[model samples]
Target: MAAKTKKAIVDVKKQFEKIAEQFQTFQILNEEGEVVNEAAMPDLTDDQLKELMRRMVYTRILDQRSISLNRQGRLGFYAPTAGQEASQIASHFALEKEDFVLPGYRDVPQLIWHGLPLYQAFLFSRGHFHGNQFPEDMNALSPQIIIGAQYVQTAGVALGIKKRGEKSVAITYTGDGGASQGDFYEGINFAGAFKAPAIFIVQNNRFAISTPVEKQSAARTIAQKAVAAGIPGIQVDGMDALAVYAAVREARERAVNGEGPTLIETLTFRYGPHTMAGDDPTRYRAKEEENEWEKKDPLVRFRKFLEAKGIWNEEEENKAIEQAKEDIKEAIKKADEYPKQKVTDLMNNMYETMPYNLQEQYEIYTEKESK
Candidate 1:
């Protein structure tokens, strides 16, 4: 029999608020673009800072262009990426050239950093199989569209790295809603148990499509989900690139040193609808909420920081923006040059030894192609 004396069962649900507060979204730069945490700031040269800002600008522009292309019917499907540039791009800067990255759909920017050319990403959204081919020797996988699947796959990749005695770590990303998935728990658990080198970043963008995160889980912070797995968990202000770079850089250090996986939760938001495939944020999000998050835009804050330091100005920024646009236009041209996908080739690519049913279908496709 259990003995209960002078004890009240803690209300775990209510306690979530406290837990969330304790983790406290880490930030170096405030919304006003001031360094609030001097100690937490990463050592960055002016050139390095400029480079970081440039990447952020590039990623933001890429997102805007892709969404426009989708809206204009030039692209088949696209996931909006307006508000989470700092979270993905900054963490990517923390990784070495050899690191393996398993990305979610929202992680295309990071994938570009990992060697998926800009045009390839566009081709991917347009449903071209050629987009699936990553650059040579880039230790990155295609984007995982099944919410939390990348977490478990990252665990496996991390284990593989460890088994090979490699110094590299595998990093993966997911959203707040993804943190509620079973695979998310399983992936972190396995990595923690085996001390596999993996970094899992949950970009808690406040909502999973139409549903808010509060309705997704009772947990206070997505980072704390790593607690039960016995790994370090942290929360960072996703809007602060410097802070994100610092957090992931340290986590990489720990992982390569035989330490287990670390879970980093980034508090972020998506300024646009979930996907351009036909969704409307106006249906659920209040205009006031949107305006509030807009104030925290990573690009705006970083540009402010650069201006204050005298390392960046509007002319320089405009040049970078213009170059990014031109580069994107070139990539799109290259993507268009790919021989339009042949249906018969598609069937042939689907099999090594084709089953009779599929082979029969392949024959039909071949017959159609010859017509």
Candidate 2:
């Protein structure tokens, strides 16, 4: 009787799995640039759709510009968000100005979407420390280049908000590669224990540098990791701008409502290498794979949706592109004109009272520069 019961349970599980296989990946727009799931559409107006499209296009253009600048030795290393614009912008649009944002290296679009001036990003690219200074009322931290480091900081900010009984939520962005770090689990656990109002946004771009997602985890979905933390997890099509916006909005709503934290896994892909100086992706991934993703490009998909709503046109596209180019150009000029950061500025921020060794070194460096 025990053997029969075990066999029956296994059979039931298999049946349910088969049913699950029929469900589609959460998407508002289909591959052919059509709205496949109207039910999942967010309450976005025509102007909002156009504005979002403009931002997406601007991000793509800026990414390309940054890569060119890096190649020309005008900027330091840069992480390109070429194909992940929709994922970042959509999630950023769902945020409130008072909420805090913790971003990884590839979140330029998110910062820009939240009114981070283009010049500031260029300044950061140019290696100026002050470029990291976000505007007042903008609760955003500087981009974290260290893998998984932002997770704990985000959790800490959220915990502070909870302590103050504030309605603010902290939005933290990380990559699939970052999930491997021990800090990821610790941060999630901390947020869960305290019921912190934090939204952990994981952009699962299928590859972490050269490593594929299959090699990174045995789990079927990154969202499943949230289950262990006792938090709600949801997977959404990261290429679908509206879908991402809706998911983040819902997560933010839950967080602000005292429902606790959420883990959002955005299924997306990166069109470029890990960074401007990184090796070619052709080594690990194939041209065909890149082509497949390009077919479902978020910008193109969203443009189609906008056209369907009668809000997109060639004139508007041209105007937006020209404006973006002018804005980016002006930013580049400003960054170029900004004074180079002095090396001594780094030592000053290291300690309240400079250690004797550091003080001596600072003097030596200053004397050498003066000479």
> TM-score for all predictions?
0.95, 0.92
Best by lDDT: 1
Range of the 10 consecutive residues with the lowest summed lDDT in candidate 1: 4-13
lDDT of 1: 0.89
For residues 1-371, what per-residue lDDT tens digits would candidate 2 score against the true structure?
A: 46553444457667546544533367778766687788878888887888888888877888888888889888886898978987898898888888899999888667777768888888787767777888886788888988999999988999999999998899999999998888889888899888999999889998888899989987667777887899888888899998899989988898889988998889899998888876788999989999999987998888888888788988988887788788888988888888777767777756788898788889887887676
Q: After superposing candidate 2 on the true structure, give the runs of residues whose Cα lies further than 4 Å from its correct spot.
A: 1-24
For all predictions, the C-alpha RMSD in Å is 2.5, 2.9
Q: 282, model 2: CA deviation in Å?
A: 0.7
Instruction: Please provide, for model 1 over 1-371, each residue's C-alpha lDDT reduced to its tens digit, 9 standing for 90 to 100.
Output: 88767655797666776667668788999998999999988987899899889998988888888887887787777888888988999999999999999999888898887888888888888878888988888999988999999999999999999999999999999999899899999999999999999999999899888889888887767888877899999999999999999999999999999997999999999998898877998998999999999999999999899899999999889988998999989998887887778887676677788888787888888888888
lDDT of 2: 0.85
Best by TM-score: 1
Against the unseen true structure, what C-alpha lDDT does each candidate score? 0.89, 0.85
lDDT, model 2, position 294? 93
User: Given candidate 2, what's the lDDT at residue 275?
Assistant: 84
